[model samples]
Target: MCGIVGFSGKESKEILKRMNDEIFHRGPDEEGFYQDKYVNLASRRLSIIDVLSGKQPIHNETKSIWLVWNGEIYNFKELRNELLKKGHKFYTDHSDSETIVHLYEEYGIDFINKINGMFAIALWDSKNKELILIRDRMGQKPLFYSFVNNEIIFSSEIKGILKYPYYKKEPNFEALNHYFTFKNIPAPFTPFKNIYSLFPGEVLIFDVEKKKKKQFKYWEIDFLKTNNDNIEEITYNIRNLLEDSVKKRMISDVPIGAYLSGGLDSSSVVSIMSKYSNSKIKTFSLGYTTFLEHKNQDIIAARKISNILDTDHYEYFMSPQELIDDLPNVLRSFDAPFSGAISTFFLTKLISKHVKVALSGDGADELFGSYLAPRLSQPLYYFEKIYKKIKSGYQLSNEDKIKLKPFENNIKFLENLYLKSNGNFEKWKYEILLFKDEEKKRLLNNGVFEYDKFNSFDLLKKDVENLKALDPLNRALELEWKTLLPDHVLAFVDFLSMVHSVEVRSPFLDYRLVEYVASLPGNLKIKNGNIKDILKKSLKGILPDKIINRKKEGFVLPVFWWLKNELKSFIFENLNEHELKNSVFNYEYVKFLLDSYYNNKENDFKLAAKIWNIVSFKIWWDLYFK
Candidate 1:
């Protein structure tokens, strides 16, 4: 909901001001600043709640502590009421920003555990001479920090930190490798060396005198023991949690709306929102002209949901040219390479035009085992077991066999690795088959051909190890919550929405709701090969039957078709060997993929991912480092 930037060692006021000015779009309502010998904190405010008294860089009554915060504290009213009864006084009843100073006074560093909201809080403890940075439990908000020249600089966006003269602009190779494999840069590792992102549910405390920083995990998900709770109880509890989450996120002083993808997640959110609102709620959906030809677009279903819910709906059908035109800006907005580009960027832009804040259903798929991998778990498990038994002795020619023994072992290894890595066997197999010997040497420079040897796989394994007691389903859900939810889905949502200065809240990502649902048995989440079964049952009476039963269509773009149609020239122009030679990709392989797409021999989604990755790299290179 706002932009916050500061430096904690030897930063001039001019540099801090410049950094704050760059993020004005995030908070255009007002700006505040606090400067001292050791620290300079600045905030750009968007007046969402308590507009008048919410002016930030807020401080305690004693002026011993100052805080510049981003995001909404949904339970601030409850916290405020509690603090008031405990003899804490407030100058204005207008802002959640004031609640932080009092909460810190009452609970100290542990205050984060007591609050339920999405926030990246930077608390300046003048008395203790330490600065504490906290990211919310679900990482709905981002906090980027760098340690340089005996100073700690932190901001809401990477660009903000780049504004400082002392900040170095260099790509971290480890991060690039992770990006290539995972399609996203994992947390605690930014694209730049020395710059790091605070992981979700993490708190970083910087001690000035000692020149030391320490991080602690304040929260984590606990596996639900198999319970005998019946379907009725499960459905009832799910309905209550979802409705409560939606209601809590609806607290806004400005206009609010919902993104109606017409998919179960978005439609369910809008359905709950409509029931809470006195008037018809405004909703937005995005599609493309090519969607008419695909016969699988969700616009028709979205229209049905809108009509059934009696909401004011706005739909935008983007042309291929429009999507191509937005590519440069969208790529620049993301600091690192991403997988799904066109659809997420354009959809987010369209939603921002109508509403300052919108509620989304991003976390449902991860939480409810709704993706293809979770749905196909049984088949994949069987396939792995069968392959393991016959793989060594199966007779085939060298060309036909494809040397999958290494990859087969790799997939099996991933089963014991992390839940996120387990279902990626197909992708791994493809990577291995496509990864030429020369390409491996070119990318890695070292002789590291084993995918399981990567730090990312190890990190995943460590996370899964912590959840050893859970079943595969629960373990996988935990891994998604730790990895995919923050890295891919939430990162995409945050950057795209913030690029247009729109605040997006995910009701499904509410920690309480996630924990509650996570406690249910696996059958409640996915039953009889159906994903989100419990969610569908819970919404049976609340949502239209058409929506409840609609096949889950994710936010997918027509990348394959675009590479052959409207985007051919655009992609070709930027993808020549000369332009991409400096990138960490095989130019010949890229050319071959493009040729295959043009010759109608391949679905170019994977190739498009490569193209987008390189394009995103080029754009980010020019924007931040150039």
Candidate 2:
């Protein structure tokens, strides 16, 4: 719940202060600074754990090691008790982050292994003349660093590093290309060259004397299935682990609330919170003012859950025009190009008004197989069987061929069992893509020299190649758990929530719970069209039947409808032909998408997603680059 900025080079307290000032919203309660011959560290504190005495740049008993941490270590109390037994003295009882410094003194760099929580830690070892940066195992908190000009600069947010006078504002087109493809530029790759985000469970140590840096991985999810897959035992274990995770996350001196979206995930969290709390729990939700037809049901569902739990519930309704008005601030808040903004931005803003910390249901979808990939695989499996029979001898009528349209164009792809069965890694990578390869070639300007050696798919390919799961569903889930959930979902949540000085905790992201779920067989998660089947069974009587069975409507905005109706003029103004011509996209192709949408020729929601991608990127490019 704070921001940290530090450097292992020429020390300047003023420059460090400027970097710290950029993220004041992250920690407005107080600020701290520490400087030595080799390192300068600055921090802004939000005072979540130890309100009066908890501060940053906290040191161990000897004061040889200083730590600026940007998250809550849920297991800090337990660690503190252990350290006390070992004769470690503590100066303050108000801070959980202080344990980090003592742990470092006791165990050195391996101290990261002794704690469990979301954190981005910058530790300076005066004795060793080195600076170490660590990101939590789940990637719940972000840490960005740059090794340039014979120095290493690191910060909780990228903007902090950019504040360094030596760093210039230059775009990383390779990252932009990857962003366009994945809807997000994955970790270790930001939208800027020579600057990188530390991957989850990653550690970077920089030696100031040698001017050298080395990175290593300390943890990753093991996707290996456990043979003890007794359904009852597994379901009971999931329930127990999730409850313990929620209880651990509720450790705070300040008030905490839940984001009750009424979706299965959020609803489950709220239900669990109500079970554990004697007082009424505060829950928040958001809906669109325009698309009542699509959103009203979710709102009603949220109200029903609130009433059943007897919680203090708050709801906010936002219009499409409000989203258009807030576009500039939204784009600026994210340090990088992020496409999933509308609902996430507004939801965080709405909740921040009432609570400083809120729990969300982010990791459930990836961990429990609740996304489209799992649900689609079941139908696609049958489709694969039908396609094989068709190829063997079945003949289709001309009308049938016409009905298939473009899918008919790639008959080989259709006939490929792996593609249909979710075994084709490349096909899954491109599934629901914002733009296809030819479309990218058409959109990007020829002058925009593609980075000669970097393939946009290298990260995706590496993730695919490393899948150890024998089950196609587990493999897909593992890929997303590794890449999408942490990079896209957690990244946006952290940046946007921090923008309002709000801290968001995700019980679903608990490492113990995640590892257990990852070890379960894929069938337990998704079976016969039931997504999160095991989760539902575990919470069978705990949650309201309506909530447990309700279709997943994740913080969904009415973007498709808005693009067609209320925001049409805004889209035209932002995505004009002149804008496209001036940038890396083809003006003709941009015009065609708008024309098709307006003329009602290609009004598919997928097309709407593409238009949004272009519009959002255009705004981001102009804001950052111009």
- Candidate 2's residue-wise lDDT over 1-626, tens digit each? 79999887777988999999998988999999999889999999988898877777799888899999899999998999999999999998857888899888889888888888999999888898889999999899999999778999999888898999899878888788877777888877899888999999999999899998889999988988475868888888889998888888888898889998888888888888888886788999898776566578888999999998899999888888888888878777777777774476787777778788888888998988866565544444445545656768877656445434334455565455455435465565466556655567777776753644355656566768887876767877888888888788888888878888899999988888988898888777876556788999988888977788887767867787778888899999978876666676777888888888788855688778888888888888888886
lDDT digits (tens) for residues 240-340 of candidate 1: 99999999999998889988888999999999999899878888888887754443458888888899999889977787788667766766666665655
- Alpha-carbon lDDT of model 2: 0.82
Alpha-carbon runs more than 4 Å astray in model 1: 224-227, 292-296, 341-344, 382-469, 581-584, 602-604, 622-626
Question: Against the true structure, what is each candidate's TM-score?
Answer: 0.89, 0.94
Relative to the true structure, candidate 1 reaches a TM of 0.89
**What Cα-based lDDT does every candidate model obtain?**
0.75, 0.82
